[model samples]
Target: MSVAAPPPSETTIADSAQNPSMNDLVTEQLVSSGDAASFAPRTALALLHYDVASTILTDLTPNELLNFALTCRSICNVVIPRYIWAHIALTPKHPRLQVITLLRKIAFSVECGPHFIRHLEVASIHVKKPYLKCRNPWYLPYLFQELFTQMQNLRSLSIIHCDKMLPHLPRIPKAIVSLPHLRSLHLANFSYLALNLLDKLSGLQTISLASPTYNVHEFLSSTTSALQKILVNSRHTLEEIRLFEVCLNVDLIPSHHGSRADADTNQELCWPHVHTLELPQCIGDGWAPALHIAFPSVRTFASPEQSHWWTAALRDASFLTGLESLHTKSSVARGFTMAGYTTRRLVIGDDMPFDVTNTPLKDLLPRHLVNLQVSLWSSYFDPTLERFTTVLPMVTPHLKYFFMRMNRGFICNTYHNQLCDIVDDIRTLPLEYLCITWDVNCGKKRCDRCVRRSCPEPVAKYVERRLPSLQALTIRVDENRRWHWKKKKVEEDGVPAGTLSLMSPTREGDILREEYAKRIV
Candidate 1:
């Protein structure tokens, strides 16, 4: 069985109690160069590079630093010089500082070095200069142009505020076309890029665009050949997007100030090949027809907003066609209504009801779904059980893996009951993996359902009825169960028993929720 990759370790902020000096923190982080070799190639290079920078930037002024480090001429000569032979003469006073200056100089001089001088790769000035003035209008385009020039091999790129900068730049298509190795590109402000730039990134495998001004029709008109994944979050109407082989992220930003009628009409954006759809923070009703037509092949879908749009979208759409999964703000009520899709995977939010206006699970669901993911945010017990009950039978006949995350009270009020139901639901199929995750707020009203409960009788019943196909089961609970010594009685028994059972728990809240849905298939 293929297991999901575990999440990264938690970052603990250092306090005076932990360390006295910045140097002490540095010492705490000091990895022997030998241990550093085990890091990912990129990570190792970045760490060593930054370590060098930490030593060099200690004494330089901002402008002097710019002139010495990032300015184009400085980058070409002192940073990444064209001739290593000319570098021997220009040495700084400090030991490692002199070494960094030398390496940058040698890197610039190598043949084909400019093409390889990516931002994250070398000491490309594009990433360095931005901190000086990120919001200044001129800084945006200047940095982007430099980034475009420097990181020719960039696989992923993100511009957070494209709207403020895209309209101001002249359209230059060729520069984007020249980038060859780019695989993923995210433009939080796509409006800053010309339609030509979109046309040029034909080699991209994944793309996310967020723009309120640009017309999506422009993108549709460009090229559909090389693109595999696309995301559009635009207020403007978009048309003719052909995405049969891609995973797409499409979001609509709702405006309370804009023309209400126009806002209402703008929600019907289409995506033809998308398998994953996420609509968060959008305002509109047009999503129904838009999704119905655009993503006829979609298998995974989600929306953070609760509206009739979801119900309408699922009704006329082909539920049995190419879909395999569905995710939304409310899990039980909304999911039960659209159960006709026969999706292999289902992700439901806790706060939402399992009951909706139209459709029921037996009527809507296909009996072949294999995975069930339940998100917890609601604290009530019975309601959460109802949500689980709704999807259980609909999913049981084909389900294999059940993932229950009960860090927050909002998901299932009875964590033990939810686990019991999940085991019971998998009776008809091979229940292979059961993952129970917990968060930090355990013992509180919001987290009681996940912690206060014990492994109840139903849990053992399922164990006896044991689905043999169930080979892997992971139970993850939060590590941060703490008590205020001053406020509460301290006892050895009062300390939680299963703290040692906690490996690294998943941070369900921080997860890009859409990432969970799209992979449902």
Candidate 2:
């Protein structure tokens, strides 16, 4: 007749749920007490089979693991290795100083170790508005060199730089190369000094050399030949390459498209495994032919922001012909339709190169598109509204995720009703996630569109009823406000319909724009 251990307290169970370190403590207590109780079929014994337990634990999300424990009366718990906390973590927000602090903690903290951090993004280094009350500006470079040295298990890394951070990047490169497991590397505002270091990295699957938001260092041109040289190290393993605007300030050669390079200046070097390629200014100055020859199997291609280049490229654009996904301005899509290119996923970012009234909007869309994101300036496209709406059902009948961004031009009457009609017309499709907004403020004189407006409760109920397969619907009538409906959340008690949802933003501002870029890539 051995005495039994008391059931674990609520505080202990909750702590174990959030803290992976506490998981072992909870399990050990239960085991010493000599009772399985409800504590998940003696998980400690299962942990003895290290490889099997590690594989199972790695696959389950914290929420999924918690749910599995609930089925066992929520009293018992699973043992998640404390070190895994580094991998399942929140990347601290932009302004890299905050990320530096998080790195300092994980680099030395007793519970969470550096080895678990497989991916790390030193998010931002905003020079204009530095948040320094005490720390010197030089602190960023020092922090990266120190903390990154400890994170040897790192599989992916990104360093996002602003105007001032470029000076500090020299010392940071050595620390980055220390990680043997590095697979992906993204360096925003990349300069030429780091060229030799990338060659040291092996087995890299993706490399992004992004341009700074402002063209501050326009003098140091990263030419097309340099781009080919960079890929020579990891061309076989690289699956994605984004050298957006890296060719900025290149010596321009005049052509039909301004700044278009007419000749193939660089030799073609193919990276057949790279299925995704993003070239903005890179296509200018004759980089297109070599790129076209190099990434022949690219399933996705983000055409240049210049519709003229996209239009010019379409003539010999064999790359565009085979793309499974396409991202460009509205005018580029019209050119795509004109050029006879098709893709399953289409993202038209609404940055028009010319007046959009010439082509029919519905005709521009590929009829078989499974996902579509389009941003439209309301006044620009108001002329074709009626005709486009009538044929949308026949066009995108297979759409699943549809995101529409509409900016209300000061002179133009609101297209709210017609926009909703576009949503209503596509009801028969199996559209799962739908977002419609009248919320883009382009920093010009304010429009009546920015004034606070909300749909009557009836409008939300109407769309929810019509789109039966729709799991999430987000509609923003006001710039700072929105309404969200999720199938599960809507059904819960105390969850009101048409509530003031937080940050259901369209892809407009700096933060959302970063997200927008990621979605297309």
Which prediction has the highest TM-score against the true structure? 2
Per-residue lDDT of candidate 1, residues 1-521 (tens digit):
11111111322111101112223222222232233333343232222332353344344443343233222221221222212111123334455544344333322233224332324342111111112232355544554454346544455444444444344544323554566665554555344244334543454445454444544445545644122222233112222222221212232322221224553344333334445555444445343444444445555555545465555545544533555665545443344445544567766654333332242445433466677776544444454344644566554566666666654543335455555654565466655555555452344565434443443334433543545454334444454431111111233445442121112233332242224333443
lDDT of 2 at 73: 22
List, residue by residue over 389-500, the lDDT tens digit for candidate 2: 3555677777777776665533223345555566676777887777776653334365545334433345566677777777666666555666665555442355554442
Pairs that collide, model 2: 39-76, 261-286
TM of each candidate vs. truth: 0.48, 0.61
Q: Please give the CA lDDT of all the candidate structures.
A: 0.40, 0.52
Query: What is candidate 2's CA lDDT for residue 463?
Result: 72
lDDT of 1 at 133: 31
- Once superposed on the true structure, which residue ranges of model 2 sit more than 4 Å away at CA? 1-144, 162-171, 194-199, 212-228, 248-268, 281-283, 290-292, 310-312, 315-318, 351-358, 379-387, 409-420, 428-430, 440-457, 478-480, 488-521
Q: How many clashes in each structure?
A: 26, 2
Model 1 TM-score, all chains together = 0.48
